[model samples]
Target: MSYGDEHRYGESARADDELFGGSGQTRTRLPDRAGDPYGGARRGGRSSSRSLVTVVGVVVLLIAAIAFANRGGDGSSSADDRGGEPAGAATAATGKRPVTTKTGGIPSGFTHDAQGAQSAAANYAVALGSTNMFKKDTRHSLLDLLYTPAAATRLRGPMDQAYSAEFLGKVGLDSNGDPPTGSTFVSRVVPVGTTVQQYGDSTAKVAVWYMGLIGMSGERSTDPVTSTWKTWTFTLQWTGGDWKIAADSQQDGPAPVPGDDRAATSDEISKAIDEYGGFTYAR
Candidate 1:
C-alpha cells in the first residue's frame, strides 16, 4: 500500500463541503453608516458599545472577504487544475514558444525553449515530490513518467528500500500503508518556485524550491507535524518524447526565520492536512 492508494486529503478533495463551513455562503452586513451617522455623537457610555459592535462587524466582513477570494480558484475546472492553457493557445498568447518542437510528453518544441524547460521543471518537481512516491505501484508509475528508463530502473530498488515497511510504521502507517484509525498521514511537497540554471536541446538543469510535510498525526507521535525548505535540482535529458531525469539531488533551505505561532493540536493539524490540496507549481 502506498500513499496514493490512501485517500487524498486537502482542499482539492473538499468539493462536496462548503469552504470554512456553510457560513461562507452567508453575507455579513455592516451597520448602515447613515443610520449611525449621529450615533458617534452619543455619550461615552453608548459610544464604546457602538464602537465595539462596529469593530466586530468589520472583522467579520474582512474574514468573509478573504475566504471568498481564496475560494475563487478552488473549483475543479480552474486553469491550474487543467495544466494551464491549451498548447496552441498558450503559444499564441505568448510569443515566447519554444524553438524545439518537443522535449518530453509536455510541449517542449516551443519558440522560447527556456519557458518550456521551466514549465517541465516545475511540473516535474510537483510530481517528484508528491505523496504518490511513497507507494510502490504509484512510485513506479511516477518514476517511469518522470525519469529516464535507465534511471528509473536504477532508482526503483533503492526507493523501495527507502520507503520500506519500517519507514511506513514510523510514519504511523500500517504495513499496507494506511494511516492508523482516527489519524492522518501527511506527506505533501509544495514547490515554492523554480529556476533554470542551464538549458540546451538535449539537457537542462532546473532547481525547485519547496516546502514539504513529513510527519505522523497522533498524540504520542514523536515526529509531529513540521515543514522544511529544500532545493531539488534535476539534471534532465530530452528522452522518449519527454524530459526525463538524468540525475537529481537535494539541499536544505533558503529558509526563513521560524514564526512564534503556536503549533496546532494533532487533530487540528490532521484536519488541516486533509482539507488542503496541493498545487501544480508554476513560475
Candidate 2:
C-alpha cells in the first residue's frame, strides 16, 4: 500500500513548532473514521494514508474561521522527557459540566466557557473521525450537527469531492462506504488531552491530541488495522447557544515510541471493536 500526504487545503506551516493555518478551508479527508473523546499527538497536517494500511485521525479543514497553534517547542525534547512526566502535565479538567445533552446521538449542549469549548472540540473530533463521515447521509448530518451553518455549507462540496468514490475504494469501501463481505472495517479516535490557545467571550480555540485506529479487521485482510497519532485544532464560536466549530485543522503527531508488545490477531481486534462500545466523550 502507498502512503502519502498533501498540502491542497491551503496547507499550513510550522516554525519552531508553531502551528498555523490558512483561511477557513478544510483539507481533503478520507480515512476509516471516530469514537471516544481525545486520542492523538500534535505535529504537522500530514494527510491520511491514501491506500490500504491507512491509519490516521480525522483531518477537518475550515475556510475562514481558524485560530490557535503551538507557540513553543524549543530546547531538547530528550531533556524535557528526561523527567519521565507526561505531556500537558499541567492540564486538569474543571469540575464544570462538559456536556448537557445529545443531539442526533452526538454530544451537544455544551457550556459557553473554555471548558465547554474543550468539551465540544473533543466530542466533535470523535464525530468527525468516525466511519460515519464516509457515508453521504451521516456525513451531512454530522456536518450540520458539528459545524457552523456557513462552514458546513462551504464544506459539503469539498468534503464530497474529498471522499470521492475513488478514495472510498482505495480505503476498502464501496460507494456506499461499506466493507467487503466477510470483512469488518474499523476507524476510531481517542483523545489524549486538550488545550486552550485562544479564548474569548464568543470564540475559543482548542487543540486535541489523540490516537486513531483505522483499517480492515478480518482474517483474510491484507491490510490489518493500524494506529496513528495526531493533534486536531478547532476554532469554535458560541453559536445559537452552544459551541460550534468555525474552522479546524490537523497535524501528523509527536507520537510516543512504540512498545514491544505482541500485536493482536484480526479476530481479536474485530471482536474487541464490536464488544467495546464507544463513550460520549466530554474531555
Candidate 3:
C-alpha cells in the first residue's frame, strides 16, 4: 500500500501538528448600531429600510408559521435527509457493518456502494498504520492483500527503502522493527469515521478520519505512546471482486478540543491499548 509514516504525504501531517486547534470560525461582528438582530441595516435610507424590513419580516413570519404547523409532527427522521451531517457529527461511526470477508488478515468483500468504500478506506487505514508496516515481511503481506497487484509491485522497493533500519531506530525500534525487552511498540490507527469523497461502480475515493497511537511503552522507554489525529484518503479500485487500494494520501486535522483529563501512566496506557481491541469501523 502507498500508506505509511515514511510517505511524504503522511510526513506532512506531522509538520502540521502545530496547526491543530478549534475548528470554530471567527465571526465578524459589525458595529453595535450598524447591524440588527434580524439582519437589517440601521443607517439605511428610510424607504430602503422599510422595504428590507417588510421583506424580512414576511419571510420570518412565514418560516415561523411553517414551524408552528409542524411543531408536533414527526420531524425527527428528517435529520437523515439534511444533505450533510451537523458539525461534529461526521467524526462519529455510523454503526453499519464493516466487511463481510477477509483475505490474508485484511478486510475484504466490502459492499458495492458508498458505504462499502468508506468501510474499505477505514479498514485499510488501520492496516496501513499498524506496527506491522515497520517490518518487511508483514508489509509485503499487507500490500499483497490490500493493494492492486500492479501498485504492490511498483511500491515494494520504495516502501522497503522507506522503512529502513535507521528509520526504525529513530522510532525506538530495533533493526528487526521490534521494541526492546519489556517494551511494547505501539503503532495503531483507530478510525473514528469515514466519508465517500467520490463514488462509482468501479472506483471510489474515500477518506477516513482516524486517531493514531505510536511510540514505545516501557518503564525505561524515552518515547511514550502519543496520539495524533489525521485524515487518510484512499483511492480505491474495485478489482478482482474487491476494493483494492490504488494509491493513498493523508492530511492532518479536523482535530477536536483536547480534554482536561490528566495523562495516563505507561502501564495504564499499555494496558488500555492491549485490552481495548480495534473495531471494524463503518461509515
Top model by lDDT, which number? 3
The alpha-carbon lDDT assigned to residue 216 of candidate 2 equals: 90
Better of 1 and 3 by lDDT: 3
Query: What tens-digit string does per-residue lDDT give for candidate 2 at 81-169?
Result: 22222233233344456776899999889876666777888888888888897798998999899888987887777777777889888
For residues 1-283, what per-residue lDDT tens digits would candidate 3 score against the true structure? 2235445534323422232212211123353453455775556598888988898997898799767643542211112222233122233344567676778777789887666777788888898888888898998999899888987887788787888898888888888999888888888998866655555578766667778888888999888887788878677889988888877767676677989989888888888878988766666
Candidate 3 stretches with Cα past 4 Å from truth are 1-5, 9-95
Q: What is the C-alpha lDDT of each candidate?
A: 0.58, 0.68, 0.70
Clashes of each: 23, 24, 0
Tell me which of candidates 2 and 3 scores higher on lDDT.
3
Ranking by TM-score: 3, 2, 1
Clashing pairs in 3: none
Ranking by lDDT: 3, 2, 1
- Give TM-scores for every candidate, taking all chains together and pairing residue i with residue i: 0.59, 0.70, 0.70
